[model samples]
Target: MKIQEIREIIKLIDQSTLTEFSYESEGTKIKLKKYESSSIFTNGQQLDSSSVVEQPKVAEVKAALAPVVQQQKEVVTETVEVAEESKLHKIKSPMVGTFYQSSSPSEAAYVQVGSKVTGESIVCIVEAMKLFNEIEAEIDGEIVEILVKDGQLVEYGQPLFLVREN
Candidate 1:
């Protein structure tokens, strides 16, 4: 299926009340899901449901690292190096999908290791339900690692890239 057609389908889904949608054609299967999370309030003020809130990448990454850190601390104990770790952040997949490193097969990979990226930079594409959603860096950083290979399947919240904050 063409990307354009898939985009249209995604548009339709977004405009409806459906939480999940799937399509299959010629041995290609696509699935899309909407993640509905509860509302968050600050200072007793309710934020609009339609607003897009950009969560801090570092905080999310740190939360994900908690278990790993505990394991390492237990393993090393007194000899554990308390040195400052690199301030690297991760660009995570927003949805479950097949990840494409570039817009097309013939195109060069978007952001590779050592590539500098800003919050607006497009690092890769995640195709969910045939819709090619451009995944952005969403943080100012230098790409330190590309965690997912081209065309690899990625889960929601999975780290796609490790970027050192600039």
Candidate 2:
């Protein structure tokens, strides 16, 4: 299905009281669901659903349309350091929230590319429902990349950083 069509469908869903929707055509499948506790799920991944009029993010829509296996293969082939990356440990978010690299706007980021970190080190913060959460690296490693930008909404279990073990 085309992206425009998907957008239209999402708009309609957002306007209505529908709790779940599913569509499949020629191997492309799309599913959208809203939970009672004010969370949206697209193909099993939770999305922020605080506002009824807010549309699903474009990235989430694209992810729902794309074939997971193909996307994985494409990502692996695109990087030259696939071998090195395969060994990198992923620091994932523990909950759905807004990601912040620093404690505050004026502060330096907790960690950056090439930054060395220990298991107890605070790598970043996640803000959910006005509470700030300090996220730890959970492993001894050097940060290779920061996957999400500061202030981006991160889902539970989403990879926040890539670390190469010491």
Residue-level lDDT tens digits of model 2 in 81-163: 77778889999999999999999999999999999999999999999999999999999999999999999999999999999
Q: Which residue pairs collide, candidate 1?
A: none
Residue range with the least summed lDDT across 10 consecutive positions in model 2:
60-69
C-alpha lDDT (0 to 100) for residue 152 of candidate 1: 93
**Candidate 1's C-alpha lDDT?**
0.76
**Model 2 ranges off by over 4 Å:** 1-80
For candidate 1, report its TM-score.
Answer: 0.50
Candidate 1, residues 16-57, lDDT tens digits: the string is: 555687765445576978665567466898776667444334
Task: Enumerate residue pairs that collide in model 2.
Answer: none
Count of clashes in candidate 1: 0
Return the lDDT, model 2, position 83. 74
What is the RMSD, in Å, between candidate 2 and the native fold over all Cα? Answer: 20.8
